[model samples]
Target: MGMTRLLRQPFSHPALPSVSFASRTIIVTGANVGLGHAAAAHFVRLGATRVIATCRSESKCAATLAGIEEAAGRKGVVQVWELDYSSYASVQAFCARADAELDRLDAVVLNAGVATRIYEVAEEDESSLTVNVVSTTLLAALLLPVLRRSADRFSSENNLTVISSEVHQWAKFPERDEANIFGSMSDPKTKTMAERYPASKLLQVFAIREIAARTHDSTPFVTVNMVSPGLNKTSLTRSTKGLEAAVIKIVNALLAWEPDVGARTLVHGVVAGRASHGVLLDHCELENDALAPWIETDEGRRLQRKVWAELERKLEAIRPGCVAAMEGKEA
Candidate 1:
C-alpha cells in the first residue's frame, strides 16, 4: 500500500462494486470483533440473506452479533457459529456444518487470525504458523466441496479469500530444509514477535498461490484470492505494549486504515471477477503477492514449491479427500 491509500482510506470505500446479497449467504471467520466483525456487519448492511460469523466462544460472540444487528437494524439473518482456528477438529466441525447446512454459499472470508509478539505453540507448531498458516489453509481446502456445491447451484460469483497483510513484504524466508521449516518454526527461541507474524503471513502468500492454481479448472467456478488490507487498526496488535504500542497507535492514527475501511478490501474480493483469481489484491487491485526477492529467483520457487507440497501432505493427513475437493465431483 502507498501513502495516498493510507491517508485517504475511509469508513466506506466506494471502490467496492455495488452488488446485492439479497439471496446469497456469506461467511466471515473470527468476526467477534475488529476487522472480522466489521466485515460481517458490512455483509449484512449490503443485504446478504444470511451472514454467519465465526468465533471461538459462542457466549462472547453474542455481543458481536448484537452489534452487527444493531448496526444493520435488522434481525433473524445474522447467526453465530463456533470455530477455533488453532484446532484442526474445530476446523473440521465447522466445515461439516457448513457443508450440510448451507444451500448456496456466495462467499467465505478466511479472516480469523492472530499476530502475537510472543512464541506460543499449538498443535506442535508455532501459534502463528498453526493458526494463520496451517489451520487457515486447511479450512480453505475443506470448504471447497461446499463452495463447489454453491457454484453449481447458484451460478453466482463465489469467493474464497484469505485476509493476508502487507507485512508479508517484511518476510525473509527462514531456515534451509523444506522439511524442517515448520519444525523449526515450532521453536520460539528462533523467531521474534515482530518476525513471526510477518513470516506466517509470508507463508500464507505462498500457500494461497498453490491453492488457487490447483483449484482453478477449465471453467472457473470459484474465485480464490488473497487480500492485503495494508496496515489497519484492529485486534491484530493486541500483544503490543508500552512504547511499542504507543508508536503503533501514532502510526495508525496517521496511516493505518480504520477497521471498516479495511473490511471493504475484503468485500471487494467477494465481487471480484475471474481475472482476480489466483492473485493477491492490494488496495483492492491485483499485484504481485510474493516478495520479489524470494519469488524472482529459481531457488525461491523451489523452496516455495517444497513448502506448498508439505502443506498438502499435512492437509491430506487430516482430510483425506482435501486435494480432490478442488477437482469437483471427481473427488
Candidate 2:
C-alpha cells in the first residue's frame, strides 16, 4: 500500500502529445526560468507560430530568448514580453498588448508564482496572495474576453490554465471563516510563513472554481482549468533558507522531476479539451475528487461563493468591470 501510494504521486517524465501547435499562439508567464522556460521552448519546438514568454524584468529578455533558442534549437518564434505580476497595471497592460498585437491566442499557462518565507506585501495584500491569487485571477478575468474572441475567430476552445499544487490539500486556511477572507489574509497577525504558499494555492483553487462555474454557460467558450505539475526541481525555493531549505533540498533530490520533464504536464494541460473545464488536472489526468474534501462540503461551497463575490469586487477595483466582462455581461 505504501508503494502504491508513492507511485500514485506524480513523478518521472510526463508524456507529451504528438499534436502540432502550428499557427497557434501561446503565452507562458515567468518563462525566463524553471518550468515556464521549459514549457515555452516545448511550445516553440512543437511548432507554435508565436510563443510569448513573459518575465518581470526587461533585462532578462535577451537571456531568456537565448535560452529558448538553445533549448528549442530555433529562434524568432518566441518573443519576451515584460509582465510584472506584482503590479495590477502591468497585468492590464500585458493584456492590452495581447489584444492589440495578437491575431489569435490558443492557450495561456499561468505559471508565474513564488514561494517565500518572508511576510512581504504587494498591491495591498500579501505578496503570494497578490501574485498567485489576485493578480493571477485578475489577469484571467481580463483575458477572458480575448480568449472568447479567439474562440470565435478560430472556432476552437482556447485554454487558460492556473498552475496549482497538491500543497493546497494541506492548507489549514484559518482565514476561511472570516467574513472578509482576503482582508484576514492581508493581516500580519494571521500570517503563518510555513503555510502561506499552500494557502495561496488553496485560494487559487477557490478562485478558479468560481471562474469556471460562472463561465460554464457562457458563449464562445474558453476552457478554464487548474493543473498540478507535482513537485519539480526549480528555483522556486531559492528564497528559502536554513532548515526549511535544507529539508526541501533533500526532498527534491529524492522525488522532484526535472523542469523539462515536469513541463510536459503543463503542455498537456493547455490542450486538455473542453472536458477539463473548471477542474483540477493531476499528472495529465482529471482529478476533480482530488480537491480538498472540505471544498465539496456545504460550508466550503458557501465560502467558495463568498470568495467569488469578494474577488469580483477586488477585480473591479483593479480593473473596473473586468468581472462582468469575464462573464460576457455588460458592466
User: lDDT tens string, model 1, 211-284?
Assistant: 88787782437888988866778878879989989998888887677787778888888877789887778778
Candidate 1 vs. true structure, TM-score: 0.92
lDDT of each: 0.80, 0.87
The regions of model 2 sitting more than 4 angstroms off are 1-12
lDDT minimum window of 10 residues, candidate 1: 9-18
Candidate 2 on 1-331: residue-level lDDT in tens? 1234335444445786567899999999999999999999999999999999999999999999999978998888999999999999899999999999998998999999998878888989889999999989998998888889998999976999989887788788878878888888888887777888888988899999999999998898899998888778899989888898999898788777889888888998998988999888877888544578788899879888888888888898888888889998988
lDDT comparing candidate 2 with the true structure: 0.87
| CA shift of 111, model 2, Å | 0.7
TM-score on alpha carbons, each prediction: 0.92, 0.96
Clashing pairs in 1: none
